[model samples]
Structure formats: structure tokens, C-alpha cells
Target: MELISDDAPKSLELENISRRFGNTYAVRELSLSIAPGEVICLVGHSGCGKTSLLRIIAGIDTADRGVIRIRGEYVAGPSRFVEPEMRNIGFVFQDYALFPHLTVEQNVLFGLRNLPRQDARTKAMAMIARVGLTHLTSRHPHMLSGGEQQRVALARALAPGTDILLMDEPFSNLDRGLREQMRDDTLSLLRSMGTTVVMVTHDPEEALSAGDRVVLMRAGEIVQQGSGYELFHSPNSRYAADFFTAFNKVQGIYRNGQIHTPIGAFPSARQLREESQAVAYIRPSDITVTTAQSGLSGRIVQRVLLGEIEQLAVKLDGLEEPICVRSLDHRPPDTGEVGISIRSEAVLTFPNP
Candidate 1:
């Protein structure tokens, strides 16, 4: 991948940006900046204000507070508000939102109207070929598959050579296999062209895979923002931890800066008064089912076969709920005592909220 030079100008910036509905703030005091060729993904569960923030940045919705700048120039703020069409930004909608009446080539040509007729036609054909849809150039939206329509929408958004691209669940409409393929293709083209991107996806895995930095949001606020590995391995809160991956939770009493769980005592990040409650969240992938005889023992109660791995439900000596563990073996252990070894780095301890 071609890296944008450090000297490349700031592509997009938002200062204390916010937007409000009738009685609620969709986006509250959000601030972010994008480099010339950076890709940032805003992700969270539904109604986390990610898409609302995206709309605010794209000028489709006005901000109730704060300033927006593009390439060091003020665009939206208290004193200035740029219209959507005036911002040199491209938007790819969730459904692609192509013109039903227009052919693939015509839909792409629609965005290049600023150029001359011949130039627009030339650019449209080039974009059509670029996305590998040259054979479907004359197909209408209804005649094309969901993935084909998405390529058309992408071509239309990018044909005009915008400085920034904003995608809202660009591959959500495609099937699983096609989604992965399209994502790789889209990122490759964007990285190659050095266009700045801020994409919104509700899928946690998608955000982790596609973004250079992942920003997880919750109720109009940023829960955490960092590289995929950083957020996945060292999340700041229980909510952030649970959002990224499934966890087996255990409650323990806080004492001497430690939380004692069923498995063992674990260190806590924050100091809590003695006798207070603390919680330990452990991911299933971090627990290894072993033959070693010295660790915590549990009886395998249930096993589920998932194509690449088997999910096991183990009942510990005194815990009420069975602890879930994932194994790559084709079959789970025979219904018998199984020793469990938990990785220290995979356990997250927090004082109870």
C-alpha cells in the first residue's frame, strides 16, 4: 500500500462537533481529524450516533455546535456552513441508492457533470472499467445484482475525484462472501488513490478489519478510539470489552487491589474499597482446555460444532452458569473433567459499576 507522506495536508477536521434532534443530542461534542489518506471507521451498536456524526461531517445535516474544516479551510461552524453539494466529498449509501432509471454508466456520469459532456463520458467509462463493471455498463439498477449496484454507486461517488469519501455500511447489502471481496477491493482502490475515508459500520469485525483506527461509540460519546488490536486487547471499559467480543463474566470481591474470581485472583486497574464488588471479563478464546492436572477443573456439559471450531459449555465446581470455551478441535472433550487455563493477558478486571 502507498503511504501518504507526513507532509500531506490535513484532509478533514472536526472541533467539538455536535448535533441535536428534538430533545436528544445525536452526536455530542465529538471531535476527530483525518490525514490525507487515512481510513477511520466509526462503529458501535445501533443508535450509537455514528451515522449521525457521519451526516454532520458530510453537510447533509447541520451541527448544533462546533466547527468543521476541510483541508485547513473552514466549512461548517458557528459562522460558516457549507452546503452538501459544495463540499468536495463523496457519499456511498447503505443501499447504494443508484438511479433506478439510469444505466450503470449513466449513474456514474451523473456525478461528473462539472466536466464537459465528452470528458464526463470518458471519465464514466474509465470508472466503470476501474471497478470491473465494464460488461454491465448498460445494465439498469433493477437489472443488476446487489453487489453490482454497490460497485456502480462507488464508481459514481469516486468518479468526480473528491478529496474525501464517506461510506455508510457500503457492503451491508452484499452476501457474506461478496462483502469480504468488496471490502478488500474498496480499500485497495482507496489506498492506491490516497483518498481520505471515514466509513460507518455497525459490525465490530468489519470495523476492525477495514479501518486504520477504530472509533467505538456509545450513546453519543466515544467509548474508545485506537488501532484494532489496541481496542480488542486493552479496552477501557466493560461495555467496550463486551461490544468487541463475547466474554464469560465472573463476580469477585475487591480487596488489596485484586479481584478474586472462580478461576483465580486477578489484578484490577482501579483501586476500590475493600469488600466492594469487582467483575472479571474473560474472552472464551483466551481460555484453553487442557490435559494438565494442576488447573481449575470443570465438567464438559455441552458441545456445539461450529465449522472451524467447537464451542463447549463447562460446569465448574461451584459456579451457577456454565463457562463457555472455544476449541479448534473437531470434537469437544468426552464428558469428563477438563482443566482450564486462563491467559493473564486475556482477562480484564474492573470495579463493579
Candidate 2:
């Protein structure tokens, strides 16, 4: 059993990876490069092919056309294919996938089969301890809590010192509180180990907060790839803009680099023909409620309290529906006429359908 060489290649590269099931393509001609020790999240709606792509990278599913290189060595290509066990990559499935009959210690030892008996046990115990589950090493999967089972799964996947780790919605099964805690704990461990990771998640907030880079996919192709802030703040398409959060879509006319809506005019960065119909997307949080004389005058017609945040629906003169505003003020005015102003920098515009 040897430690990973410091000079070993640490990047994962996929070039033109494609997979098809019958007449439908699960993954199109997709290509991405992951740097050493970088964490990348794949996010999209259901049936968007994120899981299919992960399986292809793991060697569980074959790619119809493409190249996969791990640690700078070709693992899947035209003339060569490496077995899953030989690829030195670890996978943590969504369900954890622990053997029901095996004890925690035995499960961790499964990945170190090639090592000598004593060495395998020693390494497995060390990993179990690293996950803070040393006291439960003899416990079977049925007897452990979900978080404990998650730790066991992580210990097993990491026991062999694999080059890259892949996770598919690893924390989705836990409760909200537990999910957040487990995610933070797992991230801390991965950061300390400096492991390169590729995670697939349908959760937008998780994708934004957890990954060094986020890859957003749609219908078997990547729509955008960049830091979370870049994708959220500077989305390339209307689809990308609508994916991250809720928006108050205002229909307007595009003229002179601005969108003129019923209530007010907002600047747009999108190029459009003059007088063309455009839609401005403003986040609920980006709308400011002011005194009656400050901005566009509107009457608050509805209010809903959402824990620390409050949602207010303001009815303007020309709009068919009231515009929603989210505010952090504990006791916001719920029944008065108010002025509304939008943040120009946060506005996203697209050509109306």
C-alpha cells in the first residue's frame, strides 16, 4: 500500500463525451476540464443527464463516443477502457450503497482488497476513525443512523486514497437541518484532504455554495460553466437566469438600451432591436420599497410572512398582475401606497417570446 505520489497527475478531463439510450442521447458531445483539487458541481432539472454523465465517468456506463482522462491517464477512449476497480476513482452514490450485512469496518476494507490482511484492517480502522465512527466499527448498516451511514460510505470510498471522488446528491436523503450539517462536515473533510471532486446535484443553493465551479446542463448539453457567482449574476441565457431563483418578470419594450415597463424603466445589457418586446427579470429581493414620493408609486395589496423574510405584492397602475417584493424588515408596511425601485445592476433582460 503506497501513498499517492505528490507528483502524480491530479486533473480530470473529458473530451466529447457522449452517451445514448436507444434513440435518445443521455449525454451529448460534452467536454470539461477539472483542475487539481477543484470541486465541480453538475446541476440541472430531472432527466437533464447529470447522473448519466457521472456514471460514464465512473465506468459504470459506457460512453458512445468520447475520451475520459483521470490523473492525466486515458481511462476511456476508442482503443482502451479501464475497469472501475482499476481507475483509482471513488464514487459515493445517492443512497450510500452500503452492504446491509457488512459491518462498518468490513465495508471500508472492501476497497483495500489488494492490500495484505493486517494492512487492510489497519487502513480501514484509520479511515473509520477519521470519520469519527471508530466506536461504531462493528455496527451493521441497519443499526446506524443516516448520517452515520453517510460517514461509513465516505470512509469506504476514501479508504484506498483514490485520485478523484464523485458524489450524486449525497445529502439529499437527510432532513433539512441534518442535510446542512452533513454537507458542511463532508466539505470540511474533503478540503482537508485536498481531493478533486465532481458532484451531481439538483439543488441550486447547494450547487452555488458547495462547488468551486458549477456546470449547468440542459437536455444533454452544458448551458453554462463558471463560478457560482458568475452563473447567478451573469447568466448567459434566459434558461440560466430562471434556474437559480424566482423572478418578477416584467414585460416591456426595448429601446435605447433600456426596458420600459408599466411601472418604470430599467437598463438592460442585452442587445435588441429598437422597440422590440423584451422582458426584464428582477429578483424579489432586488426591488426596494420606498416612501410614496421616491420611486414608482404602487399600493401594497398583499403580504405574506416567511420567517425572517416578508413577501409583499404591490399593484401598479398598468400591470395585469401585482409585482412581488421580498424584504427583510421585520415589520414592513403592509397596507400603504409605496414607491418601488429596482436595482439596475441586478436586472436580467431577454427578448420576449
Candidate 3:
């Protein structure tokens, strides 16, 4: 891939943007900035407005309020609006969206309409080669595998002189193996070309590993935006914590800046009023499992087989729900539980909801 221009600036800026339908807000007062050539991933569950925000940025959907700027130029707002086709933005859909009747080469050529026919063909074939699809350029979408069709879709999107690219769950449809391969390929390709990209995905792991920055959205609003490490380790809200990592919630009465639970006593923030109910969010990875039988007694009621880690459910003497622990310690499939140890630093305490 060749550079579009060293001086090209295609940074995106969204200022207090909002879009609503009837009483529901699809995108709330959201503001974000993306530097040129940065890849950002928007993540949340369904109805979180990630796709809505992506469409608004691509000019496929208009925001009801606030400004949308591309390279410091106002594209959508009260006074100005740019149509989708004129924005020089490329979009790759989750389904690949390749025309079944068109060959891979023709599908890529479709994006280079502004150029002469010969120029379009040259660029189209170049893009196909860039995506490693030169050998299958004549194949139709229906004849290609899931990953191949996706590459064709990607080539088509990038074939034009697009400044920014948007992808919505681009690899969600592929199997696990194919998804991982495509992810590495896509990121490598984008970095080589320095393409500015904003992708929306529901997969938390993908958002964590793929993007330069991850933006977590909830209820049409951005909950947090930062590096994956920042969001995972320093989440500001309980919702944010629960979204990024699975936690075993335990309820306790907060007093004197600490909460006692069935597992153990963990410190709470001073702001938590004494004697008030609090909940401790403990990550499964932090919980230690032992066969000592001397600590907090529990029995393994269920065991889940994950490739690298064993997820075990322990039923405490008095607690109703089993505490979950993910451990690398090898255990027999039918082994009984013994002891539980909770790591203090991994525990997050919040007011009971």
C-alpha cells in the first residue's frame, strides 16, 4: 500500500452530537476526537448507539444536534451537511455486502467511479492484489469463502481515494480462526496505509486488542474512552467494570471503610457510608482456588472447561450464589472445591444497586 499523502489530515471531531427517535435517544450528547491515521473501536451491547454514531460519522445518518468535522472542516451541523458519497469515506459492513453478481475485480472498480475506466481498473486490480485476492479477482462473491468475500469487501472500500474508513462488526461473522487472521490482516493493512478508521463492535476482546483507543458506549452515551489497559484496569463506573470483565458480585454491609464477605474482608472507599450496603466486584482471575480445606470452605459445584483457564463455581456455606474463579491451576474435571482466596487489589466496591 502506498501513502495517500504525507500532508493529508483526516482527523474526525464530534462535538456534543445527539440523535433521537421519539422518546429514545440513539446517540446522546457525545463528543470525541480521532487523530489522523488512528484506529478507534467503539464497543457496547446492542442499542448502545455505537452503530448510530458510526453512521453519523460516515454521513449515512445525520445528528440532530452538534457538529461533525472532518479534517477541521464542518461536514454536518445546523448550517452545513455533506452527503455520504461526497465525504470520501469508506464503509465495510458486517455482512461484507459484496454484490453477488459482480466479480471481485468489478466490485472494487465500483468504488473508483470518479476516475477514467482504465484508471479505475488499474486501481481496482491493485487493491485486489493488496488484499491478496489477485488470483481470485474473477470469482463472484457467492463462490468465495467467508474470509475471501470479506477481503473483497475491504478492497472495494479502500480502492477509492477515501480519507477515513468505517467498519461495523467487520469480522463478527467469521469463525474464530478466520476472525483472528482477518483482524491481524486488517490492522496490518491499515497501519501500512495510515488509514483513519473507526470501527464498531460488540466484542470486548476485539476492542481491547485491535484498536489504538477503545470507546465504550452505553445507552447512547460514551461511558469511557482510552487505551484498552486504561479502560480495563481503571474503569470509572460499575457498569463499565461489568462490561469489560466478568465479575463475581458479593454483597456486604459497608462499615469503617471495609466490607466483610463470605470470601474475605476487602477494603472499601471511604466515601461508602458506614453500615450501608455495598457490593464487591471480584474478577474471576483474582480468586484463588486451593485444596487446603482450611480457608473459607467451599465445594466445587460446577466446572467450566476453557482452553487456557478453568472456570469453577464454588458454593459457600452461607452464600446463595456460587463464587466463580478462573484459574490456570490444573484440576481434575470432577475435583471437589476446597478453599477460596480473594485478591484485594482486584476487588472493586460500589454501593449496592
Candidate 4:
């Protein structure tokens, strides 16, 4: 792939954008800017407006309000709107969306039709080779594997030489291993081409690993946006923490910089008002099980052996909630009794209603 022009602007900016469907607000007052060659992943649960937001960005859906700028040029706003084709954005749909009757080469070349026939054919062949699908150029979509079909779809989207690529659930159809492989491969391709990409996914792991930054969305608004490490280590909201990973929320009261809960009184680093109700979040991995007598007393209710780690559900004394702990070693105590300690530094506190 050829290097993109440094002088060319590759930024995609959304300023106070909002979209609605009659009585329902699909996306409510959202704003974010993506830099040139940067990959941003939008993640949230279904009906959270992630797809609607993406469609608005792609110019497929008109926003009810706000401005969109591509490379510093205004595209959409209160008084103006740009057509989808005029925006020069490449889109990969969830279903591959490949033309069933067209050959792989023809499908890729379809986007380049505005160019000279010979030049369009040349670009299509180059994209096919770049995606490692040259061998299946004459094949139809039905003949290829899921991964191959996805690659063809990607090639078709990229064939237009658009600097911006938007992919919606691109890897959802693949198996676990294949999904990972495709994600890695797709990232490699995008980075190599210096393509500015915004992909929408509900998978936390995929969003964390694939994008330069992850934008966590909920209820038609952006709840958190940061690097994977930043968001994982210090999430701003309970929604972000729970969405990113499995966490146990223990409700308690905060007093004198300490949280008093059924498990035990523990010092909290999180800033909180005095005598405030709060929820302490502890990731399953942060809890440690020890054979020592002195620790939080609990009864092991269940043990599940995952390949890389074992998950134990322990019912702590005086606490109705079951605390979950994960460990690599399978030396779990008997189902009747277990002792576990919460790591002080790993705890996160959130305001309780």
C-alpha cells in the first residue's frame, strides 16, 4: 500500500450531533473528533444508538441536529448536509453486503466505476492482491469462507481509495479463533495504509485490542472515551466499569475515607463526600483466595473451570451477594468453605443512589 499524503487532512469530527426517530432519540447530543490515521471503536449494548451514530457519520442517516466536519471541512450541520457518496467514506456492512451475482473482482471494481475502466480494473486487482484474495478473484461470494468473504468486502470498501473507513460489526459472523485472526489482520491492513477507521462493536475485547482509542457509548451518549488501559484502570462511571469487564459491585457507606460494607471496612482512595452511599467495584481477578484462616469468610457455592482461569463463586457472610473470584491455579477450597481477600488498590468506588 502506498503512503497517504501527509498534507491531506484525514480527521473526522462530530460536533454536538443528534439523531431522532419520531418519539425516540437514537443518538442524543454526541460529539467526538478522530485524528488522521487513528482508529476509534464505538462500543455499547444493542439499542444504545451505536449503530445509529455510525450511520449518521456515514451520511446514511440524517442527524436531527449538529455539525460534522471531515478534514476540517463542514459536511453536516443545522443548515447543510452532504450526500453519502460525496463524503468519500468507505463502509463495510455487517452482512458483508457483497453483490451475490458479481465476481470478487467485479465486486471490488464496482466502487471504482467513476474512474477509467482500465484504471478501475487495475485498482481492483491491486486491492484483491493486498487482501490476499487474488486466487479467488473469479469466484462468487457463496464460494468463499466467512473470513474470505469479509476480506473481499473490506477490499471492495477500500478500493475507492477513501481515507475514511467505517466498519459495522465486521467480524461478528466468524468463530472465536477466526474473529481474532481477522481482527488482527484487518488492523494490520488499516495501519499499513494509514487509513482513518471507525468500527462499531459490542465486544469489549475487540474494541480494546483493535482501536487506538475506545469510545464507550450508552443511552445515545458517550459515557467514556480513552485508551484501553486508561478506561480499564480508571473508569469514570459504573456503566463503563461493568461494560468493560466483569465486576462485583458491593454497596456500602463511606466515612472518613473508608468504606464500611458487609465484607469488611476497607480504606478507599476514591474521593467521596463524608457519610456518602457508594458502590465498591472489584474485578473478579483482583480477589485472591488463600488457605490462611484470617480473611473474609465465605462458602464456595460453585466452581467453573475456564481454560486459562478458574472462576469461583463464594457467598460471603452477612452479604447477600455472591462474590466471584478468578485464578489461574485450580486449587479451590471445598465447596463448603473458602477464604478470600480483596486487594485494596484494585477497588473502585462509585456514588450510590
Full-model lDDT for every candidate: 0.88, 0.91, 0.88, 0.89
The 10-residue segment with the lowest total lDDT in model 2: 1-10
lDDT by residue for model 1 over 166-277, one digit each (tens)? Answer: 9999999889999999899989998998989999999999999999989999987888988888898889888888889999999998888788876688777767789898
Ten-residue segment with the worst summed lDDT in candidate 1? 1-10
Q: Rank by lDDT, highest first.
A: 2, 4, 3, 1
lDDT of model 1 at position 270: 64
- Please give, for residues 70-121, the per-residue lDDT of candidate 2 as tens digits: 8889999999999988888899999999999999999999999999999999
User: If both were scored by lDDT, which would come out higher, candidate 1 or candidate 2?
Assistant: 2
Off by over 4 Å in 2: 1-10
Cα RMSD for candidates in order: 2.3, 3.9, 3.7, 3.3
Best by lDDT: 2
**How well is each residue in 168-253 modelled by candidate 3, as lDDT tens digits?**
99999999999999999988998899899999999999999998899999999999988888888778889899899999899888
Query: What would the TM-scores of all predictions be?
Result: 0.95, 0.95, 0.93, 0.94
Q: Model 3 compared with the native: what TM-score? A: 0.93
Quote the RMSD, in angstroms, for model 3: 3.7
